[model samples]
Target chain A: MPGEHSSKQYDTDLETIRSKVLAMGGLVENQFQDAISCFRTGNVAQAEQVIKADENVNNLEVSLDDACSHLIVKRQPAANDLRTVMATIKVITDLERIGDESTKIARAAKSITERGVTTINHYETIRVMSISASNMLHDALDAFARLDGKQAIRLIAQDELVDHEFRSIMRTLITFMMEDPRTISGALDTLWVAKAIERIGDHAKNIAEYVIYIVEGKDIRHTDYAASQLEDRTTN
Target chain B: MPGEHSSKQYDTDLETIRSKVLAMGGLVENQFQDAISCFRTGNVAQAEQVIKADENVNNLEVSLDDACSHLIVKRQPAANDLRTVMATIKVITDLERIGDESTKIARAAKSITERGVTTINHYETIRVMSISASNMLHDALDAFARLDGKQAIRLIAQDELVDHEFRSIMRTLITFMMEDPRTISGALDTLWVAKAIERIGDHAKNIAEYVIYIVEGKDIRHTDYAASQLEDRTTN
Candidate 1:
């Protein structure tokens, strides 16, 4: 009776934790969107909202951590189940960091708005990069929810595109800086936002790696594209 | 007899894991040093060495992961012993990421060196920032080795210095861009190096958090300067 009772309780607890992780992920995703929108249109109020709402994201991280430890101590779930829980714990951390990056962007946006610095020609590149990175986030989370390795792999491939956009943005900023030194502050702020978007892309890649780990028990970390090619050749 | 044999094996395995973590820490420290040197003088050979030596760091990470899993499964170490092993597992990931950041710096240095870019004046700032970040790494790892929350707390406080330095560097780059748009490419490279160093400071802060977790039953992830305040409160 004790065994049966405890097993049921663990199942319920895990479901709750999963729901909470998803909720936190949604909150983080929204924060990114809000933060980017504020930067795009110079919406100071929206940027302020993003900065103020960071506490919610921070609190979610703590709760998620507590749930992870409780599950580990109580259920001691094994293999794929263990991997899933571990992935949840790790992704929550990446999400929390993403939240922080978004806050950084929002703060930058607020500063730019207050200074009445409206000559933002390079932000178009930042906007495009933001959208691309956001798509990576969506795909990574979708893969996680479905436990699909192929989707995760595709998401990882998208990361390079974001990197390209980030580099182009840097080039544009450099050009701007060369034109007028007074534009330096705005350019640097744009650089921070671009960097934030790049970090979001990195976190997306991290989630994709976890997806592969959970699905295939493959430690794809530090592994090159050639490893897969070699595996394909050997199997064939 | 099984219990006695298990105890001896556990002790041996734990000792091996401890040694492996220290070795990994040493490799990471070396990479950071080489990366800074590469940045300082465009040392392409040194940068290549740092890049090529990344494999050793990866190997250490995998070995540590395997050892942690094996120990947890076999010994089922409880309380402080379990916390110690978990901390080791967690800190290695942070160390490996630090190594990755160093690689990034090396790459940036090599790229600029390839372009034969000059006229950068913030070289001193970059040097100072790298040293400050490396010092933070040393302090954080020392705190881990000694399980000293007080030391970890102080090391994390020092992260603010790195942040402040990064801001000043950004301002310098902005000024360069504003004065002459032609200086954009070199300034961007400089910005990337500054960012890589700031990221190292962040990883050091993360290691400090892990150390605090190991020494005290606390989660200081989202808490504001909680680790530093802990010692003062306890003393009073």
Candidate 2:
């Protein structure tokens, strides 16, 4: 139980840190949702709000890094608790990257607002995709908090749906661009937003992998780490 | 110096890993160059060649990772050696991603070839941008191998030029799309290739930062870890 004592201490620090990371994750999720809303309703003000909030998101990421470093040094955690700490570190990196992608989308949204591009069919599809992606992000973080491997595994499977939707939306946008020369700039802007949402899905999947790692103490990055682990346990 | 034995072990292991990474780096550089060559010349066979070569590039990355891990365990290298191993791990990751981006560009090229989208402009700009980006990747690796902080720092500064060229190429492509709706799909394809090139530049910059970290024993990721280290050395 030597590792368990360290686990309890690390878990206390990890729980505190996870809350902060989730707060940042929530901010980034809001940014993606609002940026899409900005494009849909021509709410330039909402886009501007999203842009302004980026600095706070970035500041939170830096603070989270600082806190993680201090906790690692103090706790020197191991095993499942160690995986949780590592997961928090990596999840924040992915979440911070998601924030950057949101900022990129917000920038594109601003440009489209300035150009006064009319709403197109693809924009609505993008909005729907963003909602689904945001939901995945929420579920992934919840799975992380609860250490729910089943939920995490389910969320990983759902990521493919987001990718499929994104490709379909890209097809529609490209088709619109092909039919009208005037839609070119706006189409590119929409493409950027879609790409951002797709990346958000990637982050959500990364979080899900972390949940699996925490629950199973296995690496699931490249290989079918999760499936193999499940198979091993059943065989045992 | 007691450090020299560890340094020699690190140096030998580092040299072995460096050569392989640079080889992989060279392969990616060629992929971008060949991908665009396929585009401009409508070389379907060459596009296929680039696509096929990606597997070798990916395999080299795996080899590089194995080499790095092996060295870390064998040498048990401290601070500077540790930094070099860490740098190798990260640089290879970047190289692998660059390979992925290059493969995407190659796929776009093949698609363009299959669809017979013959109208291509701005080839001169794209060529120049790709070559410059290719050179940046080389320079970044060279900087890391020599531990040349000044050269690494210079490469970081020059990343802006890649951005400039990429933006110009994008603007030109958009203009083409605006002039003729028929050009929209081709323009979108070209835009992704340009984005891929830009990301390679970004990865190169990341390698440069790692070079700074190893040379100065500082963390230059977000904070000015190098600048503070320089100030400390000066004061001492």
Q: Which candidate is the best by TM-score?
A: 1
Q: What's the residue-level lDDT of B60 in candidate 1?
A: 82
RMSD of model 2, in Å? 5.0
Name the regions of candidate 2 deviating beyond 4 angstroms: A1-17, A60-88, A118-122, A222-236, B1-27, B45-49, B52-89, B217-236
Model 2, range B53-154, lDDT digits (tens) per residue? 988887786566657656654665655455566656768878877877788888888888798877665456578888888888889978876779877877
Residue pairs in candidate 2 whose N, alpha carbon or C atoms collide under 3 angstroms? none
User: Tens-digit lDDT track for model 1 on B19-130?
Assistant: 7787888889999999988888888899999998898898788767767766765675555466666667778889999999999988988988888886674568687888
User: How much lDDT does candidate 2 score?
Assistant: 0.76
Regions of candidate 1 where Cα sits further than 4 Å from its true position: A1-12, A225-236, B1-12, B79-81, B225-236
In model 1, what is the error at residue B177, expressed in angstroms? 3.1
Score chain B of each candidate by TM-score.
0.91, 0.87
DockQ of 1: 0.45
Per-residue error (Å), model 1, residue B47: 0.7
Shift of residue A126 alpha carbon in model 2, Å: 1.3
